[model samples]
Target: MSYEEILLETEEKMEKAATVFSDELKGIRTGRATPGLIENIRADYYGSPTPLKQMASISVPEPRMLVVKPFDVSVIKSIEKAILKSDLGMTPNSDGKILRLQVPALSEERRKQIVNQVKDLAEKAKISIRNIRRDSNRQADQLEKKSEISEDDCKSLKDEIQELTKKFEDKVNEYFDKKQKEILEK
Candidate 1:
């Protein structure tokens, strides 16, 4: 592949890694309620597992409360069961048509734990970005070996890839810091 193609592919992959990390952070509970936390919860709908976002409407009626109203009333039980099955550690209070989830205050220890989890996720994203850089470097080296690119051009391409890796790794760190602050907030 050409140098430009290799660089572009590397950047796109790194961007995707950062985005995935951000989305995952949204699912990690904080001191408040948010639709993102439970929207991805899978429930049995007609014997098939389906995401809660597809089966219900989730609203944060209060700072610490989420109201879930299923379009199909019959799925209320399934939704409740899904919440119970999730790692969220909260039970859904259901009344036929709607379910209410109360997001409890995070203890100091829990907040620390969540922060640690965020750190782990951020590290994983950085690892993914670095892997992309490695692959792009390899492609550049191959091009140099084949004489498709001059030695200087290959070295320049590797430098560009390294810069992209640093940029994306910084973005991941930014997201992690933001999420850690959110989780630790009182």
Candidate 2:
């Protein structure tokens, strides 16, 4: 493949890594209610397992409260159980129909802990982007060795790939910083 193709592919892969990191950070809750926080919960409905989002309609009735109304009222117990079992550290209140989750404000220590988790996720995303750059650089070298591109071309491609890596790494850091602010904010 041409160097341009290689660089484009590298960028796409890095973007994917960043998107995955952002998605993971969504599961880490702040002091407010967002559907993403609880939708990921896998509820045991009868003998089948399903995501809460698929089993019910989740809404934010208040800034701190989330209402989960199941399509089938029979699954209420299981949905409540699944949420209680999740690591969100919140309890679900059900009135035999809809389950309400009250999201309490996080303690200072808990916010710090969540920030640390975001840091870890950002680090992993950087590592993935670097790995992609490394693989792309290796491919560039292979092309040069096969006489498909000149030695000078390979050097330029390597430099370009490093630039792309730095760009994506910065994007990951930006995401972490934004999330941290959200978590630490009241």
User: Which candidate leads in TM-score?
Assistant: 1
* Model 2 per-residue lDDT at 45: 83
Candidate with top lDDT is: 1
Predicted structure 1, TM vs. truth: 0.99
True-structure Cα RMSD, model 1: 0.6
Error of 1 at 97 (Å): 0.4
lDDT of 1 at 12: 92
Candidate 2: worst-modelled 10 consecutive residues by lDDT: 81-90
> 1-186 in candidate 2: lDDT tens per residue?
998999999999999999999999888999889999989899998798899999999999899999999999999999988998997888998999999889999999999998998898899999999999999999999999999999999999999999999999999999999999999999
- Candidate 1 on 1-186: residue-level lDDT in tens? 998999999999999999999999989999999999999999999999999999999999999999999999999999998999998999899889999999999999999999998999999999999889888899999999999999999999999999999999999999998888899999
Clashing pairs in 1: none
lDDT computed for candidate 2: 0.93
